[model samples]
Target: MVQAQVTRREFLKASALVAAQVTCGAWLTGCANALAASAPPPAASDAPAPIATPTLSRELPFSGWREVKYYDQLASAVVQCAQCPRRCVIAPNARGFCQTRENRDGKLYSVVYGRPCITKTTPIEKAAIYHMLPGTQSYSLGTAGCNLACLYCQNYTIARAKPEEVESYTMTPDDVVAAALKAKTKSITFSYSEASVAFEWMMDIAKVARAKGLKVILKTGGYINEAPLKELCGALDAINVDMKGFSQTFYDQVCQGELKYVLETIKTIRRENKAWLEVANLVVPGYNDDPKMIGDFCAWFKENLGDDVPVFFTRYEPAYRLRMPPTPVETMERTYKIARDAGLKYAYVGNLPGHTGANTYCPKCGKLLIERVGFDIKQNQIAKGKCKFCGETINGKWA
Candidate 1:
């Protein structure tokens, strides 16, 4: 496993100075004449700003959480959560399947509201969104619990745990926006465990971020109801939906979710046409990595999502309950070929660094557009949302 990287707090001090571009004045605390928020990024030779020690400390653990919307009250003090496809019928003082929302006396409350287990800045590429704002940073945060039960969950330590089961940091919507602004990230992302389980928190932060002229992104399993997803489409700037598998058997036996709901959610997002959309499927060996299944996935994508939306067949790591070895590089290459054979315009193989599969090529001229090493961009040849060489309009949010 890759060693853990430093936290946002335990970061370099000079990094902020380089970010501020204040060569004339510098100090241990911060730099003078900090670059304007609207200032253009520096050249490739210039080092990006190191993470600032976020002075805004985390608040206390979650308690006395607030009530959430999109729930229906039933007889005998029961409530049904309508946020995700689960539509879990919660008993009085009981929690839902995800353990993030609780039903209290016929009212539903999001127990994980304003409480995030992890909050950090990441490259937008890490979200598997290569076409939008390449090389820019995104502020990301996520709480515990997830709607779907993936056996090979990479973040099961938090994802499989209940809200109270894990230590969390309280962060209101204002606090999230403030931290994103402070970090100077291009966008704010709701990621990690599962954003859908923390519906109220994700919506609150996305709305606030949108109002502040900061773009909002969501990395989700696409296991949500239409009403809530439409609301999210209106607020979010970009969304990367995790399409777990192609077959219903795979969805039922492996992910413990329905395949139809995920497909509906993806279609709903595309129908709304409000947010930039991308799809990612974790290729787990002996689960859903069959070549026929991949071909079916590509066919479904072509029919439903067209060729513009980018799709990634990501390398699955050994984690959580699954003891399978890492997905082989040769498997990633086959998936890429499957996508190409399906006439996919922008399909990629993710998670393996320094591979040609990680790069983006123009659909028209077939010239290299973006070269990513892990989550960092090494080269970007798209300008004004078009290929620099052939001037073909790339389908994504370029601004």
Candidate 2:
């Protein structure tokens, strides 16, 4: 085990920083650990005074939450939706599959903006981003709702909830940026829930965050349409796309989504060269961890996304509708070998932290370039994005 130990209180502190950032400087001690809110509005250029808002410290109104309009009206009074592949033709008062977007009287509004149900400051490594500013903190934010219904959802409590059941607060896009600045975090991550489901809120925040020079990392399922994803790509700094399995049958039966769309999203990220993209494949015990299947996935990734792309073989835990046994550590190691044999340069195991595979090594010299004990960087051998031992160019953002 890598032994990256962090106290629960420290985790709470990180969560507090994330919450304070999302709430626009609103700090209430009692329920402060709840939802992650959006950044507060920016201050006037000439005004020296501080911009402050009344902090309603409640569990509801998760920060970084806001409604958006992404549809355009046609001559026949019909609106074309441009959010996800499931371009839900929502009628007035209807909601999309994610159950967050509401079609109110011919217009669409995201109901779960600013208010988030699942709010916690987790290890950035938990986001499985092994590269792009390693060993730094990211203010994680998300609201309730998901576009796809994966049977093995670890966060179904909030991700699958209706807007009515979860507590929410209103934080504008500016609020999200302000929170990022106040926390002095290395970056902001759209995670814990499906970011694509909250496309407008995430897209808006990414633009503002980029202007402030804060990196935006997306932890997504990669089940989005091309155009909207392309639009968001320009503002994104890095992305971790979940590739559930290698087959369409696995996607259809296990995730209630499509495999090709996710593959397309990964391809778009690489083709556009907009974001530093990584892939995570959650290996369920009996479902998608077959040796041949893993080899095919690694082979495809090597061919399309390249061998330099980081791939994480995440272990599965029983949750949501699926109550299968937890994925074995041996299974993770086995898949790692399969991927490495398939010509993938960077394949790591996750969820069982402290494993040797969690570390990053240079493919050229076979030296440990980055040693991570959980989320903490115990040793770093790379300097300025190159291997220190042999000057091998590391394939990541290394500033």
Candidate 3:
């Protein structure tokens, strides 16, 4: 049977209904029930099911750039980008190091505004945010371009590309919020690509999402400047920062960014107090997997963010520019132990599914509070934001 075509008006009405359900706290549970009831019976054929492409809004013509924020004008039509640590000073008709922002007539403009290359609804845990709103879904999106050039970037195809080099869908702030509501996701996540490259777009969509009572989460490398990071944090509800490594030398050689700036961004996020923060450290073999370095990272995390902040030691896989052997599971487990030993209460091992380290336990009583297999949460015993067994309050947006 052919599916009936949906007009824009009908789509808007449906989105409004879903938004209402979300506001009433009924969307997630209702969606779960609907999925179970509509489950298909076993099929004999082994052919893969066709994937459905998301129907995006019509492309909006642009003048190729929009006025940027957080920059300063310099001598002879040169503009200094204060967005990130690089602070690229562009001459007339030049672009920043990220290649997303350009200086047109001495005025900095973002070329990637509202042009997203990816959009989907994913589990919140996939963002490596194992604590906040566990088992929930988020509307995730990303645009091409990134401030940092990490050798082992998994999304390097888009992250390292200019806006003009990728196919993107045009979405305004209203369009993004509408899409999130239609997807029935609890939050909107800026992910995959470096969100800082598309800063204006993310900030605008985040503002709209917050106005509509939806949360905003950021998955970033945390290489942004103080002013911009503080402004973005105002609308953010949760953030997962990829810390990369502990040493400045490793950051310079492997990520093409500074360790100090990322650390400053993390500290700013904590100081803002508007967002719950989590950190991830990808352990690359022969690069930054030293036990002493891991221990120092944990100690710094404990000192700055405290013992309650969740940290994940993720196993690295060969991707993009890096072709080293995948990080061993034992290495990830050992790193996890180092964090735990350094006075961190919540530490986990990622990319090694079904390992006991992926589970969350009550800090007070050591009883398993949240059990997981990969990004799937099998059991969550957090009641009223406290451990069910010990009544110890967990630090997260559990609702």
Q: Which stretches of candidate 2 lie over 4 Å from their true place?
A: 1-69, 72-80
- The lDDT per prediction is 0.81, 0.76, 0.83
- Backbone clashes in model 3, listed as residue pairs: none
As a whole number from 0 to 100, the lDDT of residue 216 in candidate 1 is 90
Per-residue CA lDDT of candidate 2, range 1-399, in tens? 699899865665666556546543323322333332243544568322222232323343323334465666544434556678777777766778888877655666777766555433445676889888888777677878889899888878768887666544445667666655655577888887798778777777888888888888899999888877888788789999999999988998899888998999999999999889889999988889999999888888988988899999989998988898899888999998898788788899887767888889889889988887768889999898889999989898868
TM match of model 3 to true structure: 0.85
RMSD for each model, in Å, please? 8.3, 8.7, 9.0
Can you tell me which runs of candidate 3 are displaced by over 4 Å? 1-64
Worst 10 residues of 1 by lDDT: 23-32
162 Cα displacement, candidate 2 (Å): 1.4
In model 2, the Cα lDDT at residue 305 comes to: 84
Name the best candidate (by lDDT). Answer: 3
| Global CA lDDT computed for model 1 | 0.81
Number of clashes in model 1?
0
Compared with the true structure, model 1 gives a TM-score of 0.85
Score every model by TM-score.
0.85, 0.84, 0.85
